[model samples]
Every structure is written in structure tokens, then in C-alpha cells.
Target: MNPPLFDLTYCPIVPALEVIGGKWKPLVVYHIYLGAQRFGSLLRCIPTISKTMLTQQLRELERDGLLHREVFAEVPSRVEYTLTQTGLSLLPVLKAIGAWGRQLKEQQAVPELVA
Candidate 1:
């Protein structure tokens, strides 16, 4: 018998987008993918995102199984985020998205402003 055809029940990009397609999620994932990082570090990296919003994004990423949050017991508690295997699989896509964004930005730049 011929092998079953590839699953076509739904668009694959849909689920991928669902996982990484938010205003902040892709940024969160990309930074973590760059390296395991602490909560404060992420907040610094993505300025303009308020602490509450960053916290919300981190919680959602954890809930979606894309990030692992580890708490270190110390005089001051420290929390770090690392990507899960599933999350690792998604990072390259985020990188590509970043590249595409750069290209678009460059393309849209005013010639005078670019100087």
C-alpha cells in the first residue's frame, strides 16, 4: 500500500503562528534562544514592554511549554528562562523572522534618514 499522504487536516503554519505569533512572544523566545537568561535581563532587553506585560508573556510561554523557568534559592531569589526542546525547534523560525524584519526596515528606510 502507498504510504499515507502528509497530514493536511490543517495549515501547519497556523499552529506555529499560534505558538510564536504574538506581539511579544517571538521576542521573548528569540532572546531566550540567544542564551538562557534571567527575568530582569529580558526586561532590560525588551524595554518598552512593562514588567507586568513581560511577566504575562513569560507565564504564557511557560504555559505553552516553550520555556522552562528555574528559580534559584539565594538571599535574593533569581529566576531564569531556557527554551525547551520544542522551543529550541522554534528558534530558527524566530531568527528568520528577525532577519526578515531587518530587511524590511532597511527597505523602508528613507535614504536621507539612513545617513
Candidate 2:
């Protein structure tokens, strides 16, 4: 029998998914891409996501080296997030996935009936 084409032990998709696979990570990344750096801005961009969940997701992304969290010394202690090079590299993949989603939505749309 031929060897399997993919090595299950070290599948590339597994690592990628480990880094960005979650209900909120992709949306977080998408909003960050659109210049939602501050906490309030990110929260506004994805209002359906709970504040706690958003914090957890951002911390995970930062831990995974996909984002950089900056802290400013001020009266209120401002914080912001920016994508790291690793995170930026995934932009094209995200864009392609978005395009595919739009295409699928278009394909599934019901045409209007004319009189």
C-alpha cells in the first residue's frame, strides 16, 4: 500500500488551526485589519461578542505571536493591539476565505420572480 499523502503527525493545517481556530479569533483578526486597535473599537466592531470572550481571544492571539498588545502610560492606561508579521501573513488567506463566503452566499441566493 502507498504511504498516505499527508503526515497526520505534522499536518500544517493543524498548527494553523491551533493558532487561529475559534468562533471569535477570525472575527477579531478581521476587525483588527480594519483599524480596530483599541479595546473599545474592537468591542464596537463585534458587539455580539462578550467583553470577557473578546479579552480571552485577544490574549490568546497575543500569546500565539499573532498580535502585539501595547500599553500606554496615561491617566487611564490605554491599550491597543496590532497584528504581528505572522498575523499579517495570514491576511491573504483571510481575504480569500471571505471571498469564498461571499461567493457561496451569492450562489445560494434565491432569484426574484417577475410578473
Candidate 3:
């Protein structure tokens, strides 16, 4: 019997994609990689994302072992997010993707208006 064209279980990229897929995932990771981040700063950095979505993504990332969330003992409680070793390893790949996209955008962009 012939195998199915695309098997979901055996594909190597599946796990990686699961951890890093979606519009906000990479952006969230990239921002955290810049330095450890808090909820408020991530919200500011990614202005278009809603709080609900951010919370969901962060939870998934933490579940996937790509993020470490720390809570401090304080009056209001402070939480911070940072990359785990696995997440740090993925940074180069993400950076490459970002560079490729920027190059494509530059090629398609209009000339800048100099002051």
C-alpha cells in the first residue's frame, strides 16, 4: 500500500513549527530574545496583538519548553519571560527569516523622501 502524500506524524518540521508557528509566535520570541520581557513591554512592542492572544501564545511557548516565566514576590507581583536554551538556539533561524523579509520589502518599497 502506498503511503499518504503528507503524513503529519513523521514530518521533522512539525514539532519546530508547532513551537514557533503563527504570526505572533516569532515576534514574541524575538522580542523576548532582545532581553527578558514582561507582559506590559511585550504588549507595547507588539502593538497590534490583543492581551488575550498574547497570553495564549505565551502559555503555549512555555508549555513547549521554549520560554521560562518567572514570578517575583512583590506587592503587585512581577512576572518576566525569557528564552530557554532551545529558544535561544532558534534565534539565528528567526533572524535569517527576518533579514530575508526585510530584503524583499526593500526591493518592493518606494524611495524614501529625504528631509
Candidate 4:
């Protein structure tokens, strides 16, 4: 019997990108890290994103095992999203990425105009 062959020969980043490569996924994760658990709160936290796009992003994150969505049985049918253990493990990496972004912005800052 032959074993199944897995293809990961290109680069190591590919797998990571496959999990969190989209423009919105990182932002969604960041917002969730900041305690935006509910759908409405997430929408408000990232106002620039459309409702449809947010929905898509949330679904993808949930499907990828980074997010856990819980629904309550009640009249209003409340729902919430939280980071799973795997998702929480990515927090340090996310923070480092944020720090790099800030450092890059600072390094590229334009000089103030003079009179």
C-alpha cells in the first residue's frame, strides 16, 4: 500500500497564508482579540467592512477553526464569536505584526512642513 503524498514543497509561508491570507481575516482576528465578540460589535469595530464581507470573513474564520461561534437559544437568538485555543495561540504573532507595522510607519514618516 502507498501513502498519500502531501505537497508543501514551495514555501513554508504558503500554509500560513492559506489559513490567514485575506485582507479581512487578519483584521477580523485583531478585532476579535480586542474583545469584539458579538456580530454587531464586530460590525461596529470595523465599520469600513461591509456586512456581506464581514459575514464571509466570519464564516471563513469559523470554518478554519480560528473562531468558535456560539448561538443561544432565546427569543432574540443571540450569537457570539470567540477565539479558539489555536486562535489564541496566534495573538503574539499578531502583536508582533502590529508592532512591525507601527515601526514601518514611524520610519517612513514625512517631515513637517515649514513656513
| Candidate number that wins on lDDT, 2 or 3 | 3
Residue 67: error of model 2 in Å? 0.6
Give the per-residue lDDT of model 2 (tens digit) for 1-115: 6547676655668888889998899999988877639989998889999999999999999999989999999988999899988889989999888899999899779676779
Would you estimate the TM-scores of all the predictions?
0.76, 0.84, 0.84, 0.83
10 residues in a row with least lDDT, candidate 3: 1-10
Off by over 4 Å in 3: 1-5, 106-115
User: Candidate 1: lDDT over CA atoms?
Assistant: 0.86
Compose the digit string of candidate 1's lDDT tens values, residues 1-115.
6534575445577677777777999888889988999988998999989999999989988988999999989868888999999899887777788799999999879565645
- For residues 1-115, could you state the per-residue lDDT of candidate 3 as single tens digits? 7557688776777888888999999999999999999999999999999999999999999999999999999989999999999889999999899899999899779687779
**Pairs clashing in candidate 1?**
none
* TM-score between candidate 1 and the true structure: 0.76
lDDT of each: 0.86, 0.88, 0.94, 0.86
Estimate candidate 2's alpha-carbon lDDT, on a 0 to 1 scale: 0.88
Q: Give residue 14's error in model 4 in angstroms.
A: 0.9
Backbone clashes for every candidate come to 0, 0, 0, 0
lDDT of 4 by residue, 1-115 (tens): 5433575655677788888887888989988877738988988888899999999999988998999999999889999898998888888888888899998898779666779
Clashing pairs in 3: none
- Kindly report which residue pairs in candidate 4 clash with one another: none
- Model 1 misplacement above 4 A: 1-9, 109-115
Top-TM-score structure, candidate number: 2
